[model samples]
Target: MIILAATPIGNLGDASRRLVEALANAEVIAAEDTRTASSLLRALGVDNRPRMIALHEHNEVERAAELVELAREQDVLVLTDAGMPAISDPGFPLVQAAAAADVTVTAIPGPSAVLTALALSGLPTDRFTFEGFVPRKSRVPALSKLAREERTMVFFESPHRIAESLDDMATAFGGDRPAAVCRELTKLHEEIRRGPLAELAEWATGGVRGEIVVVVGGAAAASLDLPTAIAQVLALVEGGARLKEAATEVADATGLGRRELYEGALKERGR
Candidate 1:
């Protein structure tokens, strides 16, 4: 069996009993950072240390196969530096390999930065999407992809790039889109800044510290004027986005007025 364990994001007390037992009993532990895993176990007073092997982005492919081989003989536990494995971490490939090999896979669910941030974001949690981390350089495309995301969006961003990211989000989603910048979540200086994307961009200019989770409210579900809707749809289309996607982006940016954009696009496309 292959067990995917969730580790604490910040507070050590967040670690669950199942996670503790998994850490203690597993024959081998594939950890993103062996040192951190050791520290966590030590903090929890867990003495039985499993053989720890580093399995991060560079080594995950090779290590995953080895772990799967071990799983054929004994239980193997996969963990990340923080949060659940495979979530913007180096566990998806291993999970995929295990699934293909018919290995019994399970998760000892515990602390999750994504869920914690989303819950505290004061945004619509009923329908939300986790985008992990955005590309460091290919930001335009990244923002374009998110422009059409109807559900509330959650993102993990570094302190340094927070301002730039918010600016790009403002450009893609509209400057007035409501959002929250959650900083140092679950820690002593935890703070949540809620406002429009433009305001958040301005706020982040002075610098932000600690781990950052950004949650943006979905576009309002209302209609827009025909000219405004057409202009937005044309901009997206000119940026290489498809008509359907462009329509969605324009609608989300301008509120429920997507039908007008769709119709305008049809006429423009001569369809």
Candidate 2:
């Protein structure tokens, strides 16, 4: 059997009893960081020392087959530095490999930075999307695609990029879009800053420290009428957007027909 254990994101006290027992009995452990896994065992006072092997992003695919084979003989445990495996961390490859080999896989669920940040974000949680980390470059275009996204959006970001990312988000989602920036979650310096995207962008400009999770409210429920949307498209075209690009963007934002918006813009231009 293959067991996937959830590790605490920050506070060690969040470790589950099942997680402790699993660690105590694991025959072979695949960890994102072997040193961190050792520290975790010591922190939890777990006595059993399983043979630990690294299973991080750089080597997971190559090691999955080996780990799965070992699981066939005895229980194999998988863990990340924090939170559940296969989230924004490593473990998916191993899970896929184990599944392909028909090996039994189970999970010991516990602490989660994703859930923790979302819960504290103050945004509507019923409908939300976890986007993981924002793309380093091309982030603007990436966010543009989500300009019409109705569900609240969650993202992980580095401290250095927080300000610029929030600025880009404001540009894509609108400055008035409500958002929250969660920093160092579950840690001693945990901070949750909530406001409009513009405000958050300005705040992050001073720089931030520690791990970060950004949660932004979705686009407004109300959509613009077709005529209003067409006018907006034309304005964008006048501002240098290609006719198709402007029409598509406005149509997406207003839930209008792209073809109709394009036709309307062209007709207005002809007039």
Candidate 3:
């Protein structure tokens, strides 16, 4: 059997009893970081030392079949440095392999940074999307597409890129869009800042540290008329945005169809 266990994101006390038992009894442990896995065992004071193997992104694909085969014979434990495995982390490949081989896979649920940040974000959690990390390139266009997203959006970002990411989000989603920046969650210096995207960008410029989770409130339902949306798109095109890009941006913000907006802009251009 393959056991997917969740480790504490930060607080050690968050470790569940089932995770500890699994760690104590598993024959083979496939960890994202062997050093971290060893440390976790020490932290939990587990006496049974299992054979530990590294199963990180660089090697997970190659090692997945081997690990799944081991699980078929005995319990093989999967873990990450923090949070559940395969959540924007290593472990998915192994899980997929296990499923393909008809190996039983089960999870020992515990702490999660995604859920932690969302709960503390003060945003509408009823509907939310978890986008693990923001891409380094073409981030502007990516965020531009979600400018009109009504469901709250959650994202993980490194400290170095948080400021730039926030700035781009503000530009794409509007400066006044509501957002929260969660830092070092469940740690000593944990902080949660709630404000408009513009304000968060300004704050980030000063400096940021620790693991970061950003939650942005989605765009409200569009109330503008089709003529108004088309006009908006035309204005964007006049300002040098491509017709397609202009239509997409306007349509996102106004809940209009990009095709209709583009056609309307073309008609207006002909006038």
RMSD of each candidate? 4.6, 4.4, 4.4
- Predicted candidate 3 versus true structure: per-residue lDDT over 79-160, tens digit per residue: 9999999999999999899899999999999998988989999999999999889978767666665766789999999999
Task: Order the numbered candidates by lDDT, best leading.
Answer: 2, 3, 1
TM-score of each: 0.84, 0.86, 0.86
lDDT of each: 0.83, 0.87, 0.87
lDDT: worst 10-residue window of model 2: 224-233
Q: Which stretches of candidate 3 lie over 4 Å from their true place?
A: 223-271
Which residue pairs clash within candidate 2?
Answer: none
Query: Candidate 1 vs candidate 3: which has greater TM-score?
Result: 3
Please give the distance, in angstroms, between residue 254's alpha carbon in candidate 1 and its true position after superposition: 7.4
TM-score of 1: 0.84
**Candidate 3, residue 218: how far the Cα is off, in Å:** 1.4
